[model samples]
Target: MRVVRGREFVADRAWGAEDIASMNGVSTRLHWTDQPYKWHVNDGEEVFVVLDGKVEMFFRENGEEASVTLGVGDIFYASVGTEHVAHPVGEARILVVEKEGSV
Candidate 1:
């Protein structure tokens, strides 16, 4: 079993990325905080789990911009080619899991 302390993980500057497929279809936890006014697009589907604080997920659908606020324990999934931005309301800790061979 893999265990992580959220507080310490957040305090660290460099976080390592791991492959879940090597771990037998398991999910790995990740802590991330992006800069304000920045945006990202994923080539594949991804699930974001809010562990602490809040995050606003911004997206555009049908030429209209939309947003949703996600708090602790809230989860959101984004599909491939989805354009969006995430803004942390406070210091946010999130767990990112990629399914095996998903990419």
Candidate 2:
């Protein structure tokens, strides 16, 4: 069992994470970041949940760039082959669930 206080969590580097759980090849992680993540596609589905702070989520759609601002408690679902990146408004804590070993 584990308990994490998102507001109190910190990372060694941008996008650094704490492995929360793994079940049936899927993994759950808590991440802290003040920088943007690289645009990339996940091998499978991804669930992004904002735990604290805010984020501007950018993605490519129909070859055009698009984005949405996510606040605490907002959720973003990225299916396979969805090219997207996350830019934190400042420092943010996020909970991510996806296939293990996925980039």
Candidate 3:
């Protein structure tokens, strides 16, 4: 068990993550970012939750690019084959849930 104060969380580097848990084949993690993440598609679905600060989420849908601003408590769901990336407004903390070893 662990306790993370999201408001006080500082990223080790851009898009850095702290492993939280892995059960069966799924994993949960906490991520901190001060920059934009690389665009990629996950092997499985992804659940992204903003824990602190703000974020600009971008995704590719039907060959078109779109984006949205996410605040604290906002959740983003990326289904399999969904190409997406995240841009933190500043320093932000996020929770990610997905299949183990997926990228």
* Top lDDT hit: 2
> Which is better, 1 or 3, measured by TM-score?
3
Please, what are the lDDT tens digits per residue for candidate 3 over residues 1-103? 6787767767678878888889989999899889999999999999999999899999999999999999999999999999999999978999999999998
For model 2, how does the per-residue alpha-carbon lDDT over 1-103 read when each residue is reduced to its tens digit? 7678888899999999999999999999999999999999999999999999999999987799999999999999998888999999999999999999999
RMSD of each: 3.7, 0.7, 1.0
**Top of the candidates by TM-score:** 2
Candidate 1 at residue 89, lDDT? 81
**Please, what is the TM-score per model?**
0.72, 0.97, 0.94
Clashing pairs in 2: none
Ranked by lDDT from best down, the candidates are 2, 3, 1
Ranking by TM-score: 2, 3, 1
Worst 10 residues of 2 by lDDT: 1-10
Please say which candidate is ahead in lDDT: 1 or 2: 2
Q: Candidate 1, TM-score vs. the true structure?
A: 0.72
Candidate 1 lDDT for residue 84: 78
Shift in Å, residue 86, candidate 3: 0.5
